[model samples]
Structure formats: structure tokens, C-alpha cells
Target: MSRPPLPPFTRDTAIQKVRMAEDAWNSRDPARVALAYTEDSRWRNRSEFVVGRAAIVAFLTRKWEKEHDYRLIKDLWAFDGNRIAVRFQYEWHDAAGQWHRSYGNEQWEFDDAGLMRRREASINDVAIRESERRFHWAAPGPRPADVAGLGDTPE
Candidate 1:
């Protein structure tokens, strides 16, 4: 059976949800990240579609396996009623020590229960040097409360 009607998506809630999702992803725990989505969550990251939490888990597992030392930072782009759009930049190094930075945008749709039901994203990848890195959130502590909108803040 198909999923039910989507909830009233708004900018605020969407940003909040995106924050939690980012946290989970940055944690690099596939299972934890999958839990934020609906059981049948559907997603397209750079054109590949993966449905359901199981697939999300598996996809993330395979993703992290190939991407070592992954770190991500997502910024809020815009938000309507029930949908929130985001622009993000991430850094990761491969097993061979090749550093890369990816720029992307994501659109998210949430269900009534507050679980994300659908996500669409487009990303562009480029190789970069270690000195070009931006997110230096290194001194390990709690992440900012509002990471999505923390554009140039000390976050």
C-alpha cells in the first residue's frame, strides 16, 4: 500500500527536521539516520532513488564505506509551508587520501507523524586540497542548535 497524505510542511519544522537528520548523518550511523525517515522513505540523491529505511541504511552503509572521514554542513536555503529547501557543502577524504568537497541542495517532504517521507537532491563534486577545508568544528562538543541557518556564524 502507498503512504498517506503528507503533512503541512513549513519552513520552521522542515529546518528543525533537517537539523536532526544532519546530526544523524554527521554521526555516520546509518541506522540512526534511517530512523528519521518514514519506514518507506523515498529519496533521490544526485538522481539515484532509494526507498524505505532498510534501503536507506544499506545505501548509507555502502556510502560511508567508500567515503572515509566524512563531515557535512547544511545551510537552509528557503522554506515554504511543508517543504524546506537546503544548500549544503561537505568534505570527505577517500581511502587514497584524495580530498573532495561536494556542493548540493536538497528538498524534503515530511509526513503527518513528523517523519520525512521524500527527499530530492542534486550535488556537484570537486577535488580540493586539505587547506581549503571550511568546517573546522573540531574541538568536539555539542553541535549548534540551528546548524542549517548558521551560514557564517561561529558554528
Candidate 2:
């Protein structure tokens, strides 16, 4: 049965979870990343909406497959009770060798258990030449940090 939508968007845990999600996406391993959500996490990414972990995996697989050299970096936007907003951009080369920089935003809702209950995203892409591209979608994180960009924390 379908359930009600999220109540509100505010919480510290949710913010941390969002950061973890950003880290996973920047990892570039969709398989590993998919595990973060509930087994039945519901998501609306751009135009496609998917449910369950298997679907999330499949969706990510197809996405990374066509969007080669995929690199994603997400920055914290805002936070509320159990939701967080994010602004992110990724650069990827399509199968036809066309490079695109996709700018997007997302609103994430979490259950009491802190697992993502719902996700809604919007994206728009702009084409760019290889030389003009900066975020090559290649990194352990978004950037090297020293250059004043986002990067993974040292463990």
C-alpha cells in the first residue's frame, strides 16, 4: 500500500546521512552506494521514479553505464526536521562521446529509523567540450581539498 509523504525536513542525523550519501555517490560505485537506503527506498531521480534496493541498483547501473566517467559531488544545501536539501553537479561523457555537466537539486526525507523514506530530484544538463570541463567525474571525492574544493576525509 502507498504511504503518506514526509512530515517535515529538520534534523542533525538527517544532515549527516545526507553527507554519507554524498560520499557514496562520489565513490562512483553504484552497487556499494545503493546499500545505504532501505531495502525498499523510494526515489524520484529526475524523471524516473524507482522503488526498492534492486531497482535503485538497476537504475544506477544503467545510469553509470551510459554516463561514462561519472563523477558526482554534492554540497549541503539546507536541513530541517527529517529532511535535507542538496545542490550538486556531475560531469559525464555519454556513449556518443558528448560531455555534459548536469546541475541538480534534491529533497530527501527520512523515516524515524533514519533511513531514507523518499527522495525527489530535478536535473538539467549543459554540454561542454572536454577541455572546458572541470569536474571530470574522476576522484575519490569531488576535489582534492587543497585547491579549495570538496574531497573525502582522510581515514
Candidate 3:
């Protein structure tokens, strides 16, 4: 299977890839998200290490189960050859309804087929009041184009 806009990316292709990833993740559908990765993709998300698409599916299933109302946005940081880096922010409420905004960076290495073969992410979550939330788009869907990305605000 081939995922396109493959490799040695131009700036436009890299940005499109980032947006596609953001939209996939916002769907919160583990199976759907797993399609972006290779069958044997390796990932280190926070403190957990996961390998393979089956594991990726299980991990995301558990994540969305606990992180309710999850909304995410990923901004392209850089890209060269087969690698791309992204900075991201996501808002999610816990099962107990406590809100949080997570900040993170991810480095992704994709195969020539344009499927990510490796991903390493470092993330930190800050508890925030529900009123302090920035993402208000409908859940289980893509972020609307009108919503501003991380670049729109002072960093």
C-alpha cells in the first residue's frame, strides 16, 4: 500500500502531510489513524514504546478512552529528506472532566511510500480550567479551516 506525497518533500507537500495527520488524529479513530503508519511502525509516545499497527491501534484506543473530548493541531516545524518535525498542541478533558492542554514535538521518519516508519514524541501536559481551552471544534472530526493554528499565536 502506498501513501502518497512521498519523500524528499517540498514545503507544500510537507505542510499537507502535517494537516492530514492532524485531521486523522482529531478523528480519534485508532484504526483510521493506524493507516498512516507502516505495518511495523515503531513509536515512542511519552513513556510508552509501541510497535506495529496492531499495537498502535490498541494504544490509541486506550488513549481516546481516557482522554475525552480530544482535539489536536499539529504544525510543521521542519522537513528534510524522509524526515519531518512537528510541534503540536491538544486539548482534552479527563474522564473526571479536568481539562488539559498538551504541548509536544514529534519527529517522524517516513518510508519512500510516505508511510511513517518511526515516530518519537516528547509531550507535556498542563492542567487548565475548562474556560481556558483554545480548541472548540466539534469532536470526532477534522478541525475546520478557519481555526487558527499554533503559528497564529505568540510562541
Candidate 3 stretches with Cα past 4 Å from truth are: none
lDDT of each: 0.75, 0.72, 0.96
Candidate 1, after superposition: displacement of residue 26 in Å?
A: 0.4
* Candidate 2 regions with alpha-carbon error over 4 angstroms: 1-15, 136-143, 147-155
Q: Taking the tens digit of each residue's C-alpha lDDT, what string does model 3 give over 51-129?
A: 9999999999999999999999999999999999999999999989999999999999999999999999999999999
The TM-score of predicted model 2 comes to 0.79
Residues forming the 10-long window of minimal summed lDDT in candidate 1: 1-10
Q: Please identify which of the two predictions, 2 or 3, would achieve the higher TM-score against the true structure.
A: 3
The best candidate by lDDT is 3
Please give each candidate's TM-score.
0.83, 0.79, 0.98
| Angstrom error at residue 137, model 3 | 0.9
Candidate 2 has its poorest 10 consecutive residues by lDDT at: 146-155
- Give the distance in Å from residue 130's predicted Cα in candidate 1 to where it truly belongs: 0.7
TM-score of 1: 0.83
Q: Model 3 has how many clashing residue pairs?
A: 0
lDDT of 2 by residue, 27-56 (tens): 767787776677788999988989988998
